[model samples]
Target: MTFLNRQIHFTAAPKRKVLVGFILFLFLSFVIIFVEPFDTDQYHSDHKILVLSGFGILIFFVFVIYSSFENLWYLKFRKVWLVSHEIASTILFFVVAGSVLYLYNGLMINQGSYSITSHLLYLKNIVLLMIPVFAPVMLYLRQQFGERIVPLPINSVLLTGENKNEVLSLEKGNLLFIKAFENYVEIHFLDEQDQVVSRTFRQTLSNVYQQIPFLEKCHRSYLVNMTTAKEIIGNSQSAKISFIHGEKTIPLSKTYYKQIKNRLVQK
Candidate 1:
């Protein structure tokens, strides 16, 4: 995939993000409780419970926030690093924010930055409302990274004819039907609502099949995205493969029938 200008894909999930955020929030909360910030006033103890409770409340939305950024960055610029940076930056921001809260209550409050009651109220608002501001910052970081230049492949090969070696990449998806760009193929994605997202890769189908052993010659002219294929139908002259990536049917040739059919069916 590195040889071609194919987009790097990571199967990062929102649910995984929720777990990560919940873990971070919980860990921060634990540190705050055990190493409760140094305070001169007894009233400061209640603030710990308030801050932790606030984290718990905000965690549900934390999951939503991180996942939205991942999906958006994946579609917009097709870079995994953007999503990772967004996640890391957001988590680090919260860590700093939590530490600042500790400093405010532990030392600054005694130094008269704000009265004890006012600080407690500020803590409550911070817990509930800070995400709106931080989310944008994280998003901006992702956008900035997206603006960085990654050159697209300069040379391309046609996979079906004399230039068959020129195809740099080809992907098959259940949601995407065959798209012919002169001689290039692009696998498209369709969501539950039937929205399409084109995932273009530069590479010849033959070279990819040779390089990625998991791929097979599903047809004379069609190479099934092995990852997206579910089943195969027909035999020899009229063979076709069924793709799970989308419900599209692809034709097959006699030369590829039994081998490709067996490979797909066994899976």
Candidate 2:
């Protein structure tokens, strides 16, 4: 009985990948931010505390944003899109973090505690710090989670009515059958409580088939999910399909009776 009023489904990246990726990102950020390298720039060598705090905050923000956009990374061109997005996000994070550091460091310099340096050197150091954060993460996302990405249709189906603007992403798998009701269709499926639920959608049988091709055309008014079909009742001229857990039957046109039987055998 859940109501999802959205344009499309957003299946997330695998949970394991998100957990592992977050841990790796967190560890790397801590080391790069807090661990002072031997070749630290003179201008930055004294502001270790400020720099560490700034990068830490930025790293947390990046982790949240990356996880939220994980669905985008599951598309066919995932590696390219994900890496490009990470690179762009990293640059943006650097700019925001740099502005904060600039204000803090400028105040320290004015108070004569830290020495001044060329702005170009400061920007170069920020880029150097950002490289380790972005490069390896992109490579890891592409390599680790690429093959585990779920198929596009398994997660959801896009239902578009006669009006192209009227579109919805319906959950997949549980769909049992669709019945045409005049200009609209009734989508029947099992809900989480194991109860049969039917929803009215402003779409015809043909429109439904275009989005859900797996459904078998049993009659002019009905499309049944062959996987859920239990038995065929009566003869070829007047047969009806019976579904699991229910006695209600769907009329099967003689034209589609043989095709449905053949499809059942293939399954």
Estimate, for each residue in 91-144, the C-alpha lDDT of model 1 and write its tens digit.
654554544554554464445554556655555655335556446643543343
lDDT for each residue of candidate 2 in 1-267, tens digit (9 for 90 to 100): 122211222224556445545655566456655564424334354666555555445544554555456546534343234335444555664555455445454454434334446444555676556557555764565455544333356566666666557655556666678899889988877777767787777887897897788788999899998877888889998998888845668899999999998877786
Whole-model lDDT, model 2: 0.62
Candidate 2 TM-score, true structure as reference: 0.42
TM per candidate comes to: 0.32, 0.42
Cα lDDT computed for each candidate against the true fold: 0.50, 0.62
Best by lDDT: 2
TM-score of 1: 0.32
Off by over 4 Å in 1: 1-11, 38-51, 82-267
Query: How does residue 259 of candidate 2 score in lDDT?
Result: 94
Displacement of the residue 218 alpha carbon in candidate 2, Å: 0.7
TM-score: which candidate is best?
2
